[model samples]
Target: MRKIYVIGIGAGDPDHLTLQAAKAIGRTDVFFLLDKGETKQSLVDLRERMIRGYSTPRRRIVEGRDPDRDRAPADYTGTIADWRTRRSQVIEDLIAEHLKDEETGSFLVWGDPSLYDSTIAILDEILGRGAITFEYEVIPGVSSVSALAAKHRIGLNRVGQPFQVTTGRRLAEGWPEGADDVVVMLDAQQAFTGHPDAEIYWGAYLGTEDELLASGRVADVADEILSTRAEARERHGWIMDTYLLRRHASD
Candidate 1:
């Protein structure tokens, strides 16, 4: 039997690596990285840095290209399912062909794997297929949401007020009912535009040297965020951003 560790590497900062994640790095004989492409090479670079700084000297890093998906596919769920299936096969091959029995493998996820990440789901699919067998555990790390809150010096939720965490797609439908605040993630479309009256705390490339943050009434800052996101994406070839929208009490 083989064992694997899915360890969250934190939002972006190497310092955000927890003791447990550091320990997991030491336990890994091989680390698997799913490369997202040249635009996000910084992410792959960061993973390499973590592996070098924390893992054992003799550790190995296995790189694989991530399957691409349509950004605006009509069949969103079906596309995602197919993408995951492809990714699972890649991972299964990495584990079966690369790792030896009783050896351990690890994946350094960006943010807590329990959040919006799909590594766990893909691995589960691989396990279900029975092509490979291994025991695994998750080590949570600081998420971009947490990094946003920390950088902005704001709590995710107000006292006694519930907040919803959702994607930019759902946010386009409308603000969620029953929640005074919402944390929007993976929103490339600047959905915050719809709620101009809401207050927003937005951050991009959080916890890294390139981090950009803005806050104020959505009407005031939405344009700035939009322009900034565009500039950042053009500059870095990729961008990861999250924001909090808080509707005023009177609204």
Candidate 2:
């Protein structure tokens, strides 16, 4: 039987790849890549750099065109479900044809695999279809949330207080109940702007040279974050940002 590695390669930093992740890379026989087009060339470059640095010399690389989906779909959940199924099929074909018995293949994920990433779920879906057979493992890496907290020199939660990690969609709906500190990810809508009184620590393009960071009460810095985010998105053609929102910073 073949094996698969869902290795967390960290958030755009070579150093962020843990030693264990390096070992996993060395053991991989094939690397499955999804080409998201030229707009995401930087991500492709990062993965290429890592494969060259840590992978075995004889390792093979394969690319598949990533399926496109509506970025602003009205039926968000249903759209994502369809997209994931399509993506799973792409990966399943790669594994079946390229990965041979007793060999290893890998998917280098950004941030920790257990975070908001879908690689694990996609693999599970592929297996559930019973078309492929491969034992798999996950190697954790530094998550952007942890990097954001570290960059801002603050802990995620106040002592003994609880915090929740949620998406911009949920945050836009309303601040979660029973959690004072909310870490928001995938906020294409700038939901953080709604909580004007909250203290916010924000970071964009984390773990890379073009990284940006800002912190202040939302009332004081919302415009700054909005402009900065817009400019960066325009410049890079993409952006991945996360923030920690505190209901009471003085506490």
Tens digits of per-residue lDDT for model 2, 1-251? 89999999888779999999999999999999999999889999999899999998999999999999999999999999999999999999999999999999999999999999889999999989997789999999999998999899999988999999999999999989889899999999999999999999999989999999999999999999999999999998999999999996444
lDDT of 1 at 121: 93
lDDT score, candidate 2, position 82 = 99
lDDT of 1 at 213: 97
Candidate 2 deviant stretches above 4 angstroms:
249-251
Candidate 2 pairs with clashing backbones:
none
What digit string (tens of lDDT, one per residue) describes model 1 on residues 63-138?
8889888999899899999989998988888888889999999999998999999988988899899877899999
Each candidate's lDDT (Cα)? 0.91, 0.94
Q: What is residue 22's positional error in candidate 1, in angstroms?
A: 0.5
Mark the regions of model 1 whose C-alpha exceeds 4 Å error after superposition: none
Clashes of 1: 0
The 10-residue segment with the lowest total lDDT in model 2: 242-251
Q: Model 1, 62: alpha-carbon shift in Å? A: 0.8
Question: TM-score for model 2?
Answer: 0.98
